[model samples]
Target: MQSDIDPRSLIGRKAFDRDGTKIGTVDEVYLDDATGEPEWAAVRTGLFGRDAFVPLAPSRVEGDALNVPFERALIRNAPDLGVGGHISPEQELQLYRHYGLPLPGPAPDAPGSGEAPGSSGSAA
Candidate 1:
């Protein structure tokens, strides 16, 4: 029995643990590339201000509140995002490697404007 929820309304809502303890607010949501469906939510947690990626499957929206399946202890026990406030680029690469995701290339506007795809743009 799935409930109808407005995605726009969910933005900036408070997230709470199973015990009704405030964990954090929703930072950004990550979606599965193939299906473009929400997979996880980046939750801003801790005093130092870091974001933790939490599984979206175990979460539900009720009016203005987001209920997560785990307790505060469990959430805190999860791995830290590390320096620079969030996970580092190298760490992100490592995570993608661990998950077997294909590494993405630079954007269309990246340096070397007219170079061919996959070409580093130096005379060989």
Candidate 2:
């Protein structure tokens, strides 16, 4: 469910897990290259403030905060791909696998069965 809130507006918002445990502050939001949809968020966590990428599929923007359904521990261990960089497809796959979440994007349910629509399979 996409919230009316712009992902950019989510920056600096505090994020909490389903258990109401404060996870961290949203440092950045990553959008899908194809759809331009908010796909992942880089949350500043840990004592030294590390940025970890968390999937936004199960997250909701509530007022000034983002509510994620995952546990605090899980989010704390999420892959740290840093902030302000292009996330390669391989990196995206790693993130999804790390969280045990089905890979999202074109034909996410079928795993290796699909390519980005209208992006390929054409002859030059």
Candidate 3:
């Protein structure tokens, strides 16, 4: 598993393949809400084109460049965002739906549940 590295430090780092070809630069890191761990990285591909988000796990990070496990076809075929180069709210919703994560709402233990974090609340 990857350690909790600063996302800002990786923003402009080089992304590479197993063969060490220059792919692109890191754009942003997506965090898993439940774990606050990095789940994916948005990488810019193609000169002067839009970027795409690829699933990233801790094991993918190497000494300097990120070692993307999949082939270029998979990266090229991932979801495309416009030149704004950032994942938008709509895209996040789409990902959530695709992954079947519960939409954010009240905490499981609020006034109605009579429980709180660290207060005998049942784990969701």
Candidate 3 per-residue lDDT, tens place, 47-106, comes to 885576655552267777887765666566666644333345466555444433444443
- Local accuracy of candidate 1 as per-residue lDDT tens digits, 1-124: 0225444455577888888999888776554433344545566785676766555555788777888777776665555544223334454454444433455455666665453322111110
TM-score (all chains, Cα) for each model: 0.57, 0.81, 0.61
Query: Model 3, 40: alpha-carbon shift in Å?
Result: 1.0
Error (Å) of candidate 1 at residue 93 is 14
Tell me the TM-score of model 2: 0.81
- Name the Cα RMSD for model 3: 8.4
Candidate 2 residue 88 Cα shift, in angstroms, is 0.8
Candidate 2 local lDDT, 16-82, one digit each (tens): 9889898889888887765566778888885687987777887888778889888888888877776
Pairs in clash, predicted candidate 2: none
Measured on C-alpha atoms, candidate 2 has an lDDT of 0.74
Runs of candidate 1 exceeding 4 Å displacement: 1-9, 81-124
lDDT order of candidates, top first = 2, 3, 1
Listed per candidate, the RMSD to the true structure in angstroms reads 10.4, 6.4, 8.4
Question: For all candidates, what are the clash counts?
Answer: 0, 0, 0
Best by TM-score: 2
What are the lDDT figures for the candidates, one per model?
Answer: 0.56, 0.74, 0.57
- What's the lDDT for residue 97 in model 3? 49
